[model samples]
Target: MVFCIRRAYRSEQAGFRAGKFLTNPTKAGRGHVNNLRYRSSTRKKVSLLLMLRSSARILLLSQAASSSFITSSSPVSRLQSAQFRTSARTMSEMTPVFTKDACPPAGPYSQAIKANGQIFVSGQIPADVNGNLIEGNIGQKTEQCCKNIAAVLEAAGSSIQKTVKVNIFLTNMADFAEMNETYAKWFAHKPARSCVAVAQLPKGVPVEIEAIALQ
Candidate 1:
């Protein structure tokens, strides 16, 4: 009886050891599969995060490039548009002014004519406001003539400094020195001038002066 009991106990111990060995391998395999699945999921999540970060960086760079392009293009477009308009306006404003009541011609000539943005005033004798001659010596007559020219120039929207050219007609060559002294005082800009003694002048005036002034 004692031997049989010992044999039974030994047999049960052996069976328990065999069952433990077989079940341990299946449990280990299941645990390894679960670990592999977890690792794969973590790797996929990390890859998605990296792709998102790259896409975000590219989007930011694209926006920055677009902003830079707009910033550079605006000033160039404004300059080109301004240049075109200025050129057109400059061309259009170059036309001359001519009117019927521009003070009747003193001697078969226009009193003040405009061309090329300049006023060409005819030689003004010592003439009254009514275009009639005022008779006097060189000094007195020159003052009156200058006054007349001033009136015409004012009417034409110009002034003495703007005078580009001047022509002084003298009856007597002896008065040239005195006339020049007085003319110099009036015209400080010193426009291009030509003084000549003519055979005769209208209304027998001693001096007649004409000027061309810019607008």
Candidate 2:
């Protein structure tokens, strides 16, 4: 009976050891499963954070591109034109009109006419208002003609400084130097001009000048 009891006790010890071994394996497997689940959860979170950051960056870039397009396509904001009738009338109101009576023509023509910011002066000879021809050399004739043109330009609300174009007719081409010397004194700005020598002039004048001046 002592032998049998020892054997039974050994058997019981063996069974307990077997059960502990099985339990330890199951616990270890459960811990491995839990670790795998935690690892998966961490990976998913990292992926979601990366995706969110990428989405935010894309959205910011899109918004920036849209803002740039809007600014580039926008039109200018300043007023293109002003109300001329209400703003100012100096250009229109101050324009002068010279009639036949104001400056009697030396020949058969009007003195000057103002239209559209320009003064058109007829060809003026070396003659006074009373239709008397001026005498002397080419210098004297050029001075008289320039003075007549000045008067007509002034009557038309213009001046020698504003003269844009001029045409001079001289009976003698040799007198060009003398005429130009006197003409330079009247128009310091030196307007665009075309000088031609003609065989004859009205009233046998030495020089005649026509000018177009800006108001």
User: Candidate 2 lDDT, tens digit per residue, 1-215?
Assistant: 33444555465555545544444434557765765555566556556555665676787799889888766654431222234543365455444455432336755556876766778888888877676886798999888888888877776667778999999998899999999999999989988999999999987777889999997
Q: What is the C-alpha lDDT of each candidate?
A: 0.72, 0.73
Positional deviation of residue 77's Cα in model 1 after best superposition, in angstroms: 32
Residue range with the least summed lDDT across 10 consecutive positions in model 1: 95-104
Off by over 4 Å in 2: 1-96, 99-103
Task: Judging by lDDT against the true structure, name the best candidate.
Answer: 2
lDDT of 1: 0.72
Candidate number of the best TM-score? 2
The root-mean-square deviation over C-alpha atoms between each candidate and the true structure, in angstroms, is 22.3, 21.7
TM-score of model 1 vs. true structure: 0.51
* lDDT for each residue of candidate 1 in 58-150, tens digit (9 for 90 to 100): 877998898888766788877888898987776666544333433346555677776657788888787776667666667777777777777
